[model samples]
Target: MLFKEVIGQESIKENLIQTVVNERISHAQMFQGKLGSGSFSLALAYAQFVFCSNKEENDSCGACPSCLKINTLTHPDLHFSFPVQILGNLKKSDDFISEFREMMISNPYSTEQDWYGKNENENKKGIIGVDESKELFRKLSLKSYEGGYKVAIIWLAENMNIASANKLLKLIEEPPEKTLLFLVVEDLEKILATIISRTQIIRLKSLSEVQISNQLANHHGVDEAKAIEISTYVNGDFAMALHEVSSQDNSQVFFDLFVSWMRLCFKKDVVGAVAFSANIQKLGKEKQKAFLLFVLNLFQKSLLGNFSGMENVKITPSHKEFIEKFMPYVHERNMEALHTDMSQAYYHIDRNANAKILFLDLSFILFKLIKK
Candidate 1:
């Protein structure tokens, strides 16, 4: 992956290039960003840039042997450690190397949910176990195969167990000569403080709507208007934008659910809302969180439309009519309350709260807040 291939983050790319050019590369660094923000892609590109023999000023020379190997994730010096389902004897990420490479090749912006899909198992959680840390140490202990930097890119580093984190901390604290560690994290809070203290943190912001829209149109061949709509709807999440394009039915389901839930809230139908909450609980925690995020994004857009005027609102034709009708209710008076409660609901759902009861309480709150 070259810097040119990663969408947006132009400033970050320049800064990373400067680090390499000035020989100020940190031995241990953390690339922190939300999912679908292209942090992983950026980190991979950075590593490739470091390894490239014929490096260009702005990006890596893709035709170079090092670039080719790194692009295919087959470089001896470039190592990867990621969360893995410890199924039977398959305990380490190396055990799932082929699948991991395939996933990255297919979609560099893949989420943990996409990782789960590759295994066809969503129920079992993935983790960076202590054994993975042991493997990391062993790999890094070896001399760089190409007599260059040995780079280890750990994806979803927050999933590391306490033991794994501690082991990694030692490596960070006293890293081997010519070794680089890139910890790619989605949740910075989940990482151990000791580990964080040792590494330079590179924060990545979300991609712009235009960036995502251009990628959708140019690379994915999505129609211009629909691509822009999805880019706006996903709120800078490129992975979600891709999902929205490929899974229109899923978006329709979320739309129908949102419409029904809003109706229940607007009418103050507690009984109906509670029943609806029960059904939503059946979608499982991940889907439940996705739904709540969808609703939150819509509410935000609606509030924007209300305050900024409808001309500023970029919504799909399917949702435009309903949102225009709903915009007035999500004004300054209730917008804060709505955002707070919905965000809290999403947070709790992610932490495995009782979804049915939580959704019920949220529904009742929305009933009062929506029309305030």
Candidate 2:
């Protein structure tokens, strides 16, 4: 992944290049970013640039032997460690090297859910187990194969268990000569403080709306209307944009659910809302969070529909028709309240709050807000 190929993050690319030029490359660094924010891609590109024999000022020369190997993730010196499932006495990432490479090739934007889809078994959770730490130490202990930097890119490093994190502390603090550690993290808060203290942190933030829109249109071949609409709803999350494109009907699914729930609330039918809540609770926590985001995005669209200023809003023609009807119910008085309540619901859902009750309470709130 060359810097030119990775979309957006121009400033970050320049900063990373400067690090190489100044010979200030840190031994241990964490590339922390939200899922789908191009952190992984940037880190890989940076590593390739660091290893490239014919390095240009802006990017690595892709034709170089080092660039060729790193591009395929087959470089003897470029290593990766990510979350892996414990497969019947198999605890180390080495056991699933082929699957890992396949995943890296097929879907670099994947989160834990995608990782689970690839390698998890029996709904088992993926984690960086303590046993893998020993394996990590062993791999890093070896001399660089090509007499270049031994770079270890630890994807999803936040999943490391406490014991594993502790074992990595000493190594990160003082790595072997010319060794580089790239810890890619999604959930920054979950990482251990001790581990964080040992490494230089490179923060990656979300992309802009235009950047995301172009990404969708260019990468997924998504139509202009949908690319615009999805870019609006995804809040700069590239993975969510891809998911929205793949599951365009997901919008309609949420639309149907939203229309039904709001109708129940409009009639002030607590009984109906409670039953709806019960049904929503059956969708599980992850789906519940997705639904909340869908609703929040819909709220923005609906609010814009209240007036003739449709240029600022992005929605399908079919969705615009419903928004035309629903617009009167959403106003400044209620949209803020709705956003706050819905965002709060999403937060609580992450912490394992009772879904049924939470939805029930929100239903009543929506009932009153709709009438306001």
Candidate 3:
């Protein structure tokens, strides 16, 4: 991907371009950012630009042979290492390289969860193993086949196991001439300090709401109003905005359930809350997780609306209708208490706590808080 094609982050693009122009490119660099921030895309763009035979002033020439191969992620000199799961038949990320290429070509803004879903391995965990780290050394030890810089893009480098991370430390410290390593990391804290000290860290900022809305409108044919709505809810996450648009409309159901739960909480209706929890427990795990996240987002938006004075808060049509009627009940008096309760609920859900007991307990606490 050419740097020009990446949306927003004009300053970051300029900085990266200048690095190449000045010949000050670091041997190993870490592109650190939250999910959906385009860290991987930026790394790919930089790699393409670095290896492009016909490089332009600010970006790679897309028509060049190198650019073409990089665009398809088939560049002989460009290698990738990422997390993989050991399923029944699929043992490694390389085993599913075809799917990986297709997914990246289709949407580079995808999250780890999206990748897992595409591979139908959402229930399993993925990690970079010692074998993968050894393979990295093997690949880097050899000279470039195409007579250009060898680029290794390690996506989600923080997922590397202890052995892999330690093995990679020496490589990061000193690699062969004309070798570049781009480590895309979501959580910098998870990476070993030794590795961090060896690589130049480039922190990526999330796209602004305006940038997201504009891109959605131009690229996806979404109208300005709807694009803006999605942008607000997405909170600078392009992948999530795309998912929100692509997924089925379950906002009404979520809103109804949220309203009912809130009412049960306010009334101290323990029996009613228990029944409600039992009903929610019957939903699939993904649905349950989605519902919980939706509720969390809704609470955050409500708090922002009440205090942050950010008028651009976007809720679904049903949610807007409900919130308008419900806003008076969610003022400063109970906002903090509500946030605490919601956070506790999220913690419980994340730990695989019994959904029924978790929700019931949360409802009881909310009942006390709502009336406080």
Candidate 4:
């Protein structure tokens, strides 16, 4: 991925480029951003720029052997460490490298949910185990194949287990000479403080609506009007915009579930809410979190609509009427608590809590808070 290929973040691209041009690159750096913000793509571009022998003024020379190798994710000096579902003998990231590469090639903006959903293991839990960290250590300890900087890009670094995180933290402390470690992460809180202290943080902001709209129309062949509409509704999340343009059914299903769940909460219908929770438990863990995030985003939009007007908010058209009715319920009195409880539910779901019980409890909490 070249810096120019990333949708937005021109300033960050320049900063990364300057690091290479000035030969002042940090040994350990963390690329933190929201899901779909192109942090992964940026990290890859930065690596390519560092390894490019025929570097351009603002980007890597794509024709160079080093650039071509990294572009295909086959560069010996470029290593990727990511979360992997332990399936029998396939316990390490390398065991699933082919699938990961395919995913990146298909959609560099894919979210964690997209990854697990496409995994061959039916979206099982993925984690960076101790073994993966050990493997990474051994690989980095070797001499650089290109006699240049050895780049280790750890995607979803927060997925590393405590043991793995500790083992990797040691490497960060005493990193090999001419090594660049890029820890690309979505959630900073999940990362260890020890590791966090050791790495330079490179934060990527969400893309603007205009940026997303242009990408959709210019690259994805989406019609201008539809692209603009999708971009507005996605709240600067490029992945969500792509999903909308692709006409995926996940958002529709999530919309229906949110409406039903909200109605149940409004009426304090414990029986109905319990049934809804039971049904939601059937979704994969990642999907469950995605659903909660959707709900939270809706809540945020509704709150904005409440303060201003519906015209000022960019909710899905099919959801507008429902949100208009729901807006009054989510006000200053309860919006914070609503966000808190929903966020907690998402956190618990990610941690492998009993989904049925967790969602059931969350429904009860929402029943109280939404009434405020």
- State every prediction's TM-score relative to the real structure: 0.82, 0.89, 0.77, 0.72
TM-score comparison, 2 vs 3, better candidate: 2
Number of the top-ranking candidate, with TM-score as the measure: 2
Encode model 3's per-residue lDDT on 155-202: one tens digit a residue: 899999999999889788778778899999999999999999899999
Candidate 2 has its poorest 10 consecutive residues by lDDT at: 113-122
Candidate 1, residues 1-372: lDDT per residue as tens digits? 989999999899999999999999999999999768998999999999999999988889999999989878999999999999998898898999999999998889999989988899976789999999999999999999999999999999999999999999999988988999999999999999988889899998888889999999999998886787666556577888889889866667888999999999889998998899999999888678768877887888899998898788767778889999999989888888888998898889878999999999998898889883
Q: What is the clash tally of candidate 3? A: 1
Error of 2 at 59 (Å): 2.0
Instruction: Give lDDT: candidate 3, residue 22.
Output: 95
Residue-level lDDT tens digits of model 2 in 147-212: 978988888998899898887787787787888988999888999888888878888878887988
Cα lDDT of model 4 by residue, 97-211, tens digit: 9888988878888888788888755557789999999999999999999898899999999999999999999999999888889999999999999999999999988898799
Q: Rank the candidates by TM-score, best first.
A: 2, 1, 3, 4
What are the runs in model 4 whose C-alpha is more than 4 Å off?
A: 248-372
Q: CA lDDT of each candidate?
A: 0.89, 0.83, 0.81, 0.87
Candidate 2 vs candidate 4: the TM-score winner is 2
